[model samples]
Target: MANYERKIPILDCGHEYTRRVLHGKWKIRILLYIAEGINRPSELERHIPQATRRVLDAQLAELFKHGIIAKTIFDESVKHVEYYLTDLGNSLMPIVAMMGKWGNTHIDKLRKAINTSTALA
Candidate 1:
């Protein structure tokens, strides 16, 4: 058995707060898809086919709670809802772009390491 010691950080730290907002697996992807104009829940689900509606909805709720995204319920007979990024959410786009850029730059090396580890196992 492996010894799993956990260390906790100060929750009030600004950087930690920011990380909490972007903590979920689907949250960042949801933000990017919204930035790309996939504003509806169904559209987001379609764009992120790997995530189920339940998972996406949970992430969306968290994002909405953190004010990173806003859900607008339309006044229609059929009732429509759309998501828009708040200013804070818009502010995350560049960071996301940079993250993607960094991943792209190092993907070959990262993949090689993962493949080697998998083969070793």
Candidate 2:
């Protein structure tokens, strides 16, 4: 993980806290996918092929640390694990859904802005 410190401390605000908790690139998608029953790490990997397994594992660990998801390990001939949304994670679904809705609604404009920024960069 990259090591750095912000000159300014994070604000003691709910919005800032929420943003921090969901800060990683794939975290929101991970939460949504887990909620939709794509719980296994392998399944999640298949669903989000753009993210490396290492990054996904890091985000998953962060989510678990925040109490947003619970991990269950099954010991059989082969060991396997699955993730499920906790109560807190379930509560955040509506907000996530609304964000998705807003993005879809403004996709054209957002795409243009993103492309413009990417080109500039």
Candidate 3:
């Protein structure tokens, strides 16, 4: 069996905290959609058809609570709400992009490694 190696920690808890918020199946996608200006719930649903309405709403709410996203309510005759990434959330865009790049580049290698390890087992 190959031993697992520990990499250098970026910060004591920053990585863990970021992972916690980005842990949801749809969280990163939702953030990207919002960043691209899909603000309303309906728009978000349209963008991510695989995500159910209930799950989308719940995830957005959690993002809001984490200060990653903000909702602006337009109090007009017809009330309208739109979601946007907060500065904090915007800061994560680069990190997310890097993750995407890394995943795209290394997922195949990861799959091969896993398969090899499983075969050995």
Candidate 4:
């Protein structure tokens, strides 16, 4: 009879959820822009000129669905819509900032490692 060993289960990733929210071209930029007081869709588009309107709209929809952002519609004179981070989304700021700082600190080392690995290959 063959003996089987059980491997420990991997922990679920809360950080991964944050990373997932930031995934893709415009998502992070949009979130950061919103945090910096750029709230409207047109303003977000302006901030991220490289992103297509369709893509930006899609990502905004995803953010809205995930409860990361809230959309407010105005009924006054001209139709206006604004996006803002929910309390949940605001709570992720520190984690994202830390990730940015860590990335900045380790980027040089990561680049060197990549270069070495590619050279070996």
Candidate 3 per-residue lDDT over residues 30-111, each given as its tens digit: 9989999889999989988999999999999999999999999999998988999999999999999999999889999988
Task: List, residue by residue over 1-121, the lDDT tens digit for candidate 1.
Answer: 9997768655788888888988988888899889888899999888999999999999999999988999899989888789999998999889889989999999999999999999999
Q: Which of the two, 1 or 2, has more TM-score?
A: 2
RMSD of each: 4.5, 4.2, 7.6, 5.3
- Tell me which of candidates 1 and 3 scores higher on lDDT: 3
Model 3, residue 81: distance off in Å is 1.2
- Supply the global lDDT for candidate 3: 0.92
Steric clash pairs (candidate 2): none
Q: What is the number of residue pairs that collide in model 3?
A: 0
- TM agreement with the true structure for every prediction: 0.84, 0.91, 0.77, 0.74
Clashing pairs in 4: none
Candidate 4 Cα misplacement greater than 4 A, ranges = 1-16, 109-121
Q: Which should have the higher TM-score, number 3 or number 4? A: 3
Tens digits of lDDT, candidate 2, 82-116 = 99999999998999999999999999999999999
For residues 15-80, could you state the per-residue lDDT of candidate 4 as single tens digits?
667667778777877888888989988988888889988999999998998899998999889998
Ten residues in sequence with the least summed lDDT for candidate 4:
9-18
Give every collision pair in model 1. none
TM-score leader:
2
